[model samples]
Target: MEESIPTCTAFAGHKKIAAGPVVEVAGKVKRYQDKNPDAQILIFDDSSSQQVELDLRGTVADVLSRIPGNQDPDQEKSGPGRPRLGVVSREIGLLPRHWDWLALQPGGASVTLRKLVEEARKQNRSKDAMRQSQNAAYKFMSAMAGDLPHFEEATRAFFAKNRSLFETLTAGWPKDIRDHALKVGELAFHDDKSANP
Candidate 1:
């Protein structure tokens, strides 16, 4: 027969029962208050083989800094000044890198992580499209002169080749760029028609 494995659980929010930011949720026979304001059930693995430690003081940050970069589930960069989504990334054992705002939406509405990525990508594409439209009206061509057609051509050829990068770079373009872009577009269109005619 296997000896009983020791376990410890941490509770947050309600201190009347527990001691620190994190109090033992499971341990010696002590009455602990559930932290969730809504009384939502917080579940953890009840494995008998694993030894559990109740770290009340350890924020998600503490657990995150321990995992090796390669071991981190996130492919993105983990650094300070990270956004709110960084919490999600860390919770999922990932370090913030590429995406600033990380949200966990259902995968293709599926349970699989790949489905989650697909959803993230789809959402990113739409966001980028919206960002691109938020451009200023002048000097747009100056900024986009070397990049827009290439982006258009590339995206038309391979959407994966470009994702949120263009929008990121262009989202805050100066108002002058927008006006310049329009003028350039008109000239280019005229030139194209004349050449073809």
Candidate 2:
């Protein structure tokens, strides 16, 4: 198993029930279901902070054991050269001038294109992550706090990167909800200048 196996955090209304591996979180939701029959239990991916629905019923272990991105069972074993990189070959249509420009680059068209893509991805990563985080927060908030006071203001503050404003707006919310909202917001708005702890 991968050490960094992603976690999914489970929430019900204003309360957070679990945060851990998918299986464990699913189990927690199952337990929580009994006592809070009317509650809406939601699971959010920790990295994306986006809501994910789990099929937690019968044979869950069997289902989870087949999580995607695991090695393909029927595929032939690897003969190594740079460890595969999960590369896949595909055809792309490009204008003549585009190909001409790429052909002049240092490594060959494929390598040049790959490097360009990686550079663009690196440049946009923080922005992309922030957008995903905001979207995730918005989805959760819409479901859980649509009726709460300052909802719109809080959302505006969230995307505006005004933490104090966001905090003030959510101050009257239930503690669980407020804290979770803040948590999701933080996940979305990581500062590029800050070092990872």
Candidate 3:
């Protein structure tokens, strides 16, 4: 008797276990998982019979950001929308000052966390540092588009469609992700509105 793992089934989410161009599938699911937790995705290639499993833990925005060519997923042919995923970062609270120090860092991501923390802690709270910290915080803040009309629109749609779910799921957002999640809501509002109206 021979047992077989289901070929086109995605576990723990709606993502189907199928295959396509590995890179594209990876890119798609990367964004898919970033936006939802209970949502699953499906990617299948009939030729090679490859499959992928994606558990969206957050908005697909982060994945879109990393895709190089297309930074704006909202403008693309975003296929059927699935429940957004929830992504959790293990890092500690990062204030504006921390962000400033990180900005000055050449390659903070690759550096050892201990070393990075030590360097950040070593910087004194002088007037110069304070000014620099303010600048850095502003830089990080600028990364998010508050006035983008699209942002407001997408959030409105999501709010109208998934009011209860969004509230319950978003309520548990960790300290580090609260602001980002809010921004995602803003973008989603823009997207949803554009789609329907």
Candidate 4:
């Protein structure tokens, strides 16, 4: 399950139950749960390196289809007058000045708006990513480390990117939980830094 490329990793308690594609990861969870009915499993998305929850109650096919790469084939076929850039026509209400400003741009209003949106997304990508990662890690730590020592400080240190302090605070935690907290917290900090820097 360990690949050089990033992939989702799932753990049932301290044991890694699955790691790879969503389908493969889901399958592994199924198998693991089949043997250990009471085991708690947590999933982590590789890109954000944050915990992700999978509803294993669904069929394998259903789960696979939800993954990004497993989109339905029919959805790829373009209809007449429909651009293939996955753009959907939607009406946007803009003030007269806004419309005028957009019209002055080289491209039409739609193109200008699209460019603006893209630029904003690029500008906020790191902040948004870090926020998501931090939230995910915080959710996990809150659930698992509520009873552990220095929980609040650890959380603050987590957002502050004080990795050494975070590690020290979590040192008394269980090995598996401690390691995961550090991993996800570090990821959030790194993402935030990369975004802001």
How many steric clashes between backbone atoms does each model show? 19, 0, 43, 0
Stretches > 4 Å off in candidate 1 = 1-112, 123-125, 133-180, 183-197
Query: Model 4, clash count?
Result: 0
What tens-digit string does per-residue lDDT give for candidate 3 at 13-132? Answer: 322332334445555566545455445454432222233434333455444345433445565443333312222235567688866777677666424455755576555324333333
Q: What tens digits encode model 4's per-residue C-alpha lDDT throughout 107-185?
A: 7887888898989977887787677668767877876678888999988998888878888888887877787666655
Cα lDDT tens digits for candidate 2, 1-197: 23488787888867889888887777678767756778888888866667777765545454455444443655645554333565666678999999999999898998998898989977777677676667767877887788999999888888777888888998999887777767766756566553122
Model 3 TM-score (2 dp): 0.18
Q: Please give each candidate's TM-score.
A: 0.17, 0.69, 0.18, 0.66
Off by over 4 Å in 2: 1-4, 34-39, 59-63, 69-85, 88-96, 103-110, 187-197
Error of 1 at 180 (Å): 7.4
Relative to the true structure, candidate 4 reaches a TM of 0.66
Residue 31 lDDT in candidate 4:
71
**How much is 166 displaced in model 4, in angstroms?**
0.8
* Residues forming the 10-long window of minimal summed lDDT in candidate 4: 77-86
lDDT of each: 0.33, 0.74, 0.39, 0.73
Rank order by lDDT, top first? Answer: 2, 4, 3, 1
Which tens-of-lDDT digit does each residue in 125-164 have in candidate 1? 5444333322221123322333544434422322232324
